[model samples]
Target: MKLPASGEGDVSPAVHHLVKGSAGGVTALFAHATGFHGRVWEPTARRLPGIDGHALDLRGHGDTVMPEGYDYPWAAFGDDILAAVDGLGRSGAGTGSGPVVGIGHSCGGAALVLAEAARPGTFAGLWLFEPAAFPPPAPGEVQHNPLVEPTKRRRPAFPDRSEALRNYTSKSPMDAFDPEVLAAYVEHGFTDEGDHVRLKCRPLDESQVYVSSLVANVYDAMAEVRCPVLLVQGAETPSGRFGKLTSQFPDARLEAHPDLSHFGPLTHPERIAASIRVWLEGLGTRI
Candidate 1:
């Protein structure tokens, strides 16, 4: 689906998304991490029954069309999430009829926080994994994000999807991902060209996203979110300061997995799905 930047009363380039599952049940809106697309949630969505899932591609990622000369801003990512939820309501997908849950990872998790803060009551609850919701750097402080250069150095092309899959399965971070999730990433995260397939999210664009994260104040907006939140992170690989973040939210809990990593959602979909199910059950929401 294509939607406006801020959903309603706002206009900007179209945002692309994929929706599935039957309506009249819980509605789930999924936002992906930087350099990853919406379809990466397919594995987790499959485990979730009776949920209307809407997975969105943020600007400059996946199939979302990025306007020329517009560098990615973290705030705009929040707008894109709002637009995706609004699109669901317009499509009669039961956005209001049932609970709306925001499931996000890494930067996607930060976007969800920004969205709910920007528009209170947009999400009934939020399930985030290692959300990159860092406090903004001090004024005039030199910001140094360690991930920027590595992101800029990412390989953007492969001889074929098979080669891409092989390389990722053998590589460091992606090698830790679930096979099915990695398959979905290999299939939907790239576009076919004459002789090769190129990653839809350019290395430079992804690097810009990291650079923008340095200035993002998503942590400050945490207090604006009034809904219950479940923050999940790998004990072995905590991304941000969860203790401080939990204190900022009105009602929130943090869970750490000893064996999981920052990519826990992708690396262990079943475990993540079980956690989501248990949390929803605790909230008295039907599966």
Candidate 2:
């Protein structure tokens, strides 16, 4: 589906997203990590029955179009979530008369925090996986994103999905992804050209996203988030960075997966879905 641009920044006029399951009971809005499209959540969405899952392709990722000279500010991504939520409400996908639950990972998780802070009561609850929201750097301290330089060197085109899959499978991080999940990533994360397939998220754009993460600190704003939050992280992810997150929120806890990594959602959808189901059920939600 297409939605109007968030209008929070110099963004394109349209936003693209994907929806699953029409048997609405509780609507689950999902936001993906940077460089990933919304459809990558399909594996987990299908695991939980009776959920109206709406996965948004954050600006510059997936099929969402972007305007020239537009810098990807993290706040604009939050507004994109707002736009999608409004669009869903208009379409009756989220007309339950209350805030919906949010499921997000990495950059997506931070964006959810930004949204809830920008507008209180925007979400009833949030299940975040290693959200990039960090405390503001101390005086004279400098924060840098190590992924930016590597992301700039990412290949932007491939001969086809097969080639892309092969290339990623042979690499580090991506090689850890679940086979099915990685397949979806390759299938929907690229667009076909006359002779080759190009990544929907250009290398330069994705690199900029990494650069923006360091400066978009939402730790203080999290105090305004009255909703319950569950922050999940793999044992491998340094607890030093994610542990303090629980203390920033009014009602929040941390969950660890010793067997999973930061990309646990993509590496083991079933496990992540089970955890989400248990948390949602504990909140008194049906199914």
Candidate 3:
């Protein structure tokens, strides 16, 4: 299951990840969204008890630290996905596994798609939740990601974990999450910086990810995906409704849950997991 890096001598940092699910089951890789650590997938991973899950804290978002001068290009995330999937094989997580599937949210989901695009047959299937990609720019249209300013405006350092918890619990998106999930975000989402707690994922770094939306034309890559792709979207995803997403992939299904949001995987892991479980069953022995 070793996948080659896309560029010559362009080495990516080894990803930091955690595994879940039963030992003898399908191998699944989970990627998190912007401003979140990999542990955020714990709830959903647990729901997929039949899946052997691996969760990655992509680059700057979690415990994995990038070397100095690392350029957070959109393509680099694709490389990281390939490297992480390759790592699962080295750890025997992907070896002799029933199925190797990728499950991701937003940026994470898009990365999985890019990884599959880079190396066909690398994954058995894909489950993506409102991954951030749009049709290619119209000729010379400039990059116009709306989240950059909002990310820049985010508070960089929290006084303490309790304060962080309170802030998120009282905040907009986080307010919509489960208490346990919110606690998880506060626990692993930040680090101690002197007397204060700084965000594990820097604000500018996350903004860079959002602003680099066009790093690759995922819409163009969608047509080349040979594996089954299940596009998951919440009832009210801020990314809007991508109704045409199913037509882009060769073998794709769309699931728009009525009560979910962009970060629904965090708040409704069991629900999302159940959806995945049903999808796997429908796939029969392939999963």
Candidate 4:
């Protein structure tokens, strides 16, 4: 498999990205969750055929640096995705054949939906894996969970990058991944901080992310989407949990895998990829 030379630089709301594949028509851009980097999609990307693949590090995650005072709003993450798409489109990487497919996981899934809604026809289709779009809080209710707080707080900072990597890999949902694949995640998911290197994701940023989810309304923008959408959800997920929002889309299909968890792409990339391939084929896209 050919891999594009990875490069780093600033790109507005988002900081950097590790790009792969040729600058050809009809590309698929991937977005990952808060604690994860774009490399999480490497396994799936390797299995996909034909289309160019680009994995992006969303704001405040992976190698990307969030803009100052960004507040880590979910909408800002949507803007960053648009910036990446524009960057690729302007570079002639996404022009020509078909609209780019935006594939996202967890919170990334919400951002992708937001991006598509924000700009109809901007994406050919959307493939989302268990996006964490829970229902909005009841009226006059306020969440106080630490995971939903938006205050800056210190977290464990390792003395070495390897230690941080070890800590992350040992506890991740993708712990069973091949060593080489796990190592790739470590390389792109951390930063050296002299006495200690720490995972690139900050706790406060993660908290803000959860809080943002509670307030953002992905369903509100569903009608704006003008393309096919495939939502792959975990069967264990309660039917009404994700804002009961699936019914909002005019052209959407839902596939639930009973045995899969939220980490379907990482834990079952081949299955997910095959499902996606079949779905795309049904859409009349030559694969």
TM-score of the candidate numbered 1?
0.90
The TM-scores, one per candidate, come to: 0.90, 0.92, 0.89, 0.82
**Model 4 spans with C-alpha error above 4 angstroms:** 1-25, 67-69, 137-146, 149-155, 172-181, 285-287
Give the residue spans of candidate 3 off by over 4 A: 1-24, 67-70, 138-143, 236-241
lDDT of the structure predicted as candidate 2: 0.82
In model 1, the Cα lDDT at residue 129 comes to 91
| Per-residue lDDT of candidate 2, residues 122-228 (tens digit) | 88799999888887788998889999999989999999999999999999899999998999999999999989999999988999988888778578777888888
lDDT tens string, model 4, 41-121? 777777777667777777778767664444666776777778777776556554346558888888888888888888777
Off by over 4 Å in 1: 4-23, 94-96, 136-142, 236-240, 285-287
lDDT score for residue 147 of model 2: 91
lDDT of each: 0.82, 0.82, 0.76, 0.69
- Candidate 3 displacement at residue 158 in angstroms: 1.4
Clashes of each: 0, 0, 0, 0
Of the two candidates 1 and 2, the one with more favorable TM-score, higher being better, is 2
Location of the lowest summed lDDT over 10 successive residues in candidate 4: 1-10
